[model samples]
Target: MIETVIVVLHLLVAIGLVGLVLMQQGKGAETGASFGSGASGTVFGSQGSGTFLSRLTAILATIFFLTSLGLAYYASHKASAVQEAGLPDPMLQIEQAAPEAPVSEDVPVIEEDFTPASAGEDVPAAPE
Candidate 1:
């Protein structure tokens, strides 16, 4: 349950980080805003959305990293727990379950003639 929650939070933080990055203006965008492009009219005030979005993005990134670590921990622990449980390995189970072929003494044997070809035999010519 806790792992599931962490996974969900990680996904939400990742999405939010992407959105925040996309929403923030690049350095070149400031030139247009300076010439009355109306960036000052944004909800974050006259300084524009830079500081607010940047801070939010940083926070989300931190959360994303933490959740990643948490997920890794959970995975490692789960693997260890499975090992401790003494469960049969999947490959071993498959090998054990396979049926062995029967050894029959009455099997038919194929015989082949090994005589060398005669010079008069009709051999196909090799393509040039």
Candidate 2:
């Protein structure tokens, strides 16, 4: 149950990170700044959306990394527990059996038995 929660959280953070990173503007976007774009001086100051979005992206990325490590640790621990319990692992043990050959052509094939009607009985003639 806990593992499931962690996995879900990890996926969500990963998706959010992708979206945040894509939403952010590239550094070259500031080329418009030299042309005196009004957006350079926003109420949030010069840094504006760049710093806020980058911070959020970083936080989500960190969470994604942590969750990935946690999931790996959990999987390893679970596997070790199964081993410690002395339960047989089917994947670790497999035996191959010998294959048998098909029927050889040298063997005789038998046909079904059938008997024809006797000719001694009065036979009816076909109408012309």
Candidate 3:
């Protein structure tokens, strides 16, 4: 449950960080604001928006980093818990459960004929 909460907070903070970064104006945007582009009439006021958005972005980034660490800790903890449970690994269980091939006694075996050939037998000659 705590891990779930941390994961949700991490996602929310990540999205908020992206939105805050997108909302902030670039350095060159000041040229447009000076020429009556009306950027100065924002809800947070002219200079206020810059500092407020930057600070909020920083806070969200910190939260995102912390939640990432929390999630990693939970993952490692769960892995360790599984190890402590003394359960056999699934792969080993699968190999142990497989049936071995059956041996058959009906198949005929070839035997070598060690009898000497008669003197009149026609044997192929070896290559010279």
TM-score of each prediction: 0.67, 0.65, 0.65
Quick one: best lDDT, which candidate?
A: 1
> Which of the predicted structures, 1 or 3, would earn the higher lDDT when compared with the native?
1
Off by over 4 Å in 3: 38-40, 89-128
Prediction 2 global C-alpha lDDT = 0.85
Q: lDDT values of the candidates?
A: 0.87, 0.85, 0.84
Could you give candidate 2's per-residue lDDT for residues 33-119 as a string of tens digits?
Answer: 778887856865776688898889889988998999999999999999999999877565543243457779999889877766578
The weakest ten consecutive residues by lDDT in model 1 span: 33-42
lDDT of 3: 0.84
Range of the 10 consecutive residues with the lowest summed lDDT in candidate 3: 39-48
Which candidate model has the greater TM-score, 1 or 2?
Answer: 1
lDDT of 3 by residue, 54-124 (tens): 88888888888889989999999987887799877777889989979888999889899899998768887
Better of 2 and 3 by TM-score: 2
